[model samples]
Target: MNARALGLLLGYGADRLLGDPQRGHPVAGFGTWALACERQLYAPSRTRGTCFVVVTTAPWVGLAVLATHLPASRTLVTAAFTWAALGGRSLEREALPVHELLFEGELEGARQRIRSLVGRDTSALEAPDLARAVVESLAENQSDAVAATLVWGALAGSPGIVLHRCVNTLDAMVGHRSERYADFGWAAARLDDVLNWLPARVSLLATAAVVGATDGTSAARRVLTGASRDGARHPSPNAGPVEAAAAYALGVQLGGLTTYGDRVEDRGQLGDGRPVSVRDIRRAATLTRQVGLVVLGAAVTATAMGGRLRRR
Candidate 1:
């Protein structure tokens, strides 16, 4: 019932659910539902206008009712489901397949796979571009999927987490500037921007804390300052800080030319480190895991303190 116990349960449950084919992979279900809802609810113009009001309003009302009557175990189960559902497919393992394809000199194959995971073109990308894309995706997703869900779950329980995931899922499915989604995805995009506002900064701070702890306090301070100045330069509002911090912590350069379908987007670079490489991608993953652990620990601690205060 306490935050720490709840956070541990949620975190442990997420790890256990990973690679679980029997449940059809938990994150996949979340993505499926989200995509389905967007296709159904927003694809129609009349419905799209009311999407935000409907989605946000319904969940809080439902959660209020559930909180009043639901048993603790049931609430926890719901929370666990929300965590897995929001994460989508396990990109952590999926990244390895991409690495292997690139490792074998399968440029075409790697590019094809990369298309599914990112909005950019991988066909013309060299090794450094490929590595940068992977690292960027990993860093951004750490805030969007992992850190955001975990923090919401700890603070507000299952329904709160589920609501956050729904916003995120909707954004991913329909939120883009492409002609097909421009109007319909507007609500989802705005909502995602609002939801991610705090979590994004929290994620950057968490990354800085971990880097400082692992490297040194001075290194952490430099990374934080770099992120504060350079993070906003990235196209996404929330992704900049985490990516900037990671680039600084790992001593790698990120951001450059990114090709989308037929257009190329040249983003400003974040860190002053070396160009990306395969080793950098792997190191980024390692750093992601390390930050995840630290965030989990902090969530648990905060939850414990809350329980004590309530008892008093």
Candidate 2:
């Protein structure tokens, strides 16, 4: 296998086995640095936000470029970055506990646990709403944290993955519709939208492909139908389709009124079937794993083909 492809697989394997590092995670460290920079760089101006992005992300991305150029260090660096960038296992770990809490009828515990997974308010959520939150987070994050990371890593090696993660992190930090961030987060939000566009599609299709492979064509059609009907109605260009796909794949409804602090959004109806239940969360987790496997196989196959073509 090519070094890039090998590194990608190694990193994915490590993530599967180890989850994220317990301490000193590079992404966590980056978050700290970015927060410090934001204090000094904060402004309502888009220009200032743009500078913040450059200052925070450029150094790391530049280092990736340099390290990737070294034959001896390329694969190791790519593997390390890929492991840092992907969060599928952590997504599962965090999500399933909410399921456990809900299963045990610990509504308050579920609500508290769910706060770690979603930005939406959880204190008043009932079981159905709590289930929806976890499922929705799983669906959206499957693309944002896993598929996108793999796509960029395959396409541009270490620098591509790092850039995508940085932009995404910045978006998560500042991309808000609130008065405080509407202007300052514009660039990060826009850049995140652009970078995630293709990855979201890939995730949507991968979800359908897995469903079709296991459950046959009729089941898969639901995945496509859900996206076609409701994907555009949601606010995020990337997340809407992915969540819609998951909603159908698991045969549950998602996306309705969501509360983030004082803000309320009508996320639109995403799928057909009964309202989401705690059981659906487990199903969503399984579907996420299947989708990740499919993406991994596809990336490795594509990389191998490209390497062969170059040699020939």
Quick one: best TM-score, which candidate?
Answer: 2
Tens digit of per-residue lDDT, candidate 2, span 190-294: 999999999999899899999999899988887887786899989889899999999888888889899999999999999887899889899999999889888
Off by over 4 Å in 1: 1-4, 7-10, 16-68, 72-75, 86-89
TM-score of 2: 0.98
Model 2 lDDT-worst window of ten: 69-78
For each candidate in the order shown, give its overall lDDT on alpha carbons: 0.71, 0.91
Q: In candidate 1, what are the lDDT values of residues 225-271, reduced to their tens digit? A: 99988888888888888889889989998877677787667667889
Q: What is the lDDT of residue 279 in candidate 1?
A: 72
In candidate 2 the C-alpha lDDT for residue 45 amounts to 89
| Model 2 local distance difference test score | 0.91
Q: State in Å the error of residue 66, model 1.
A: 2.3
| TM of each candidate vs. truth | 0.87, 0.98
Point out the worst 10-residue segment of candidate 1 by lDDT.
80-89
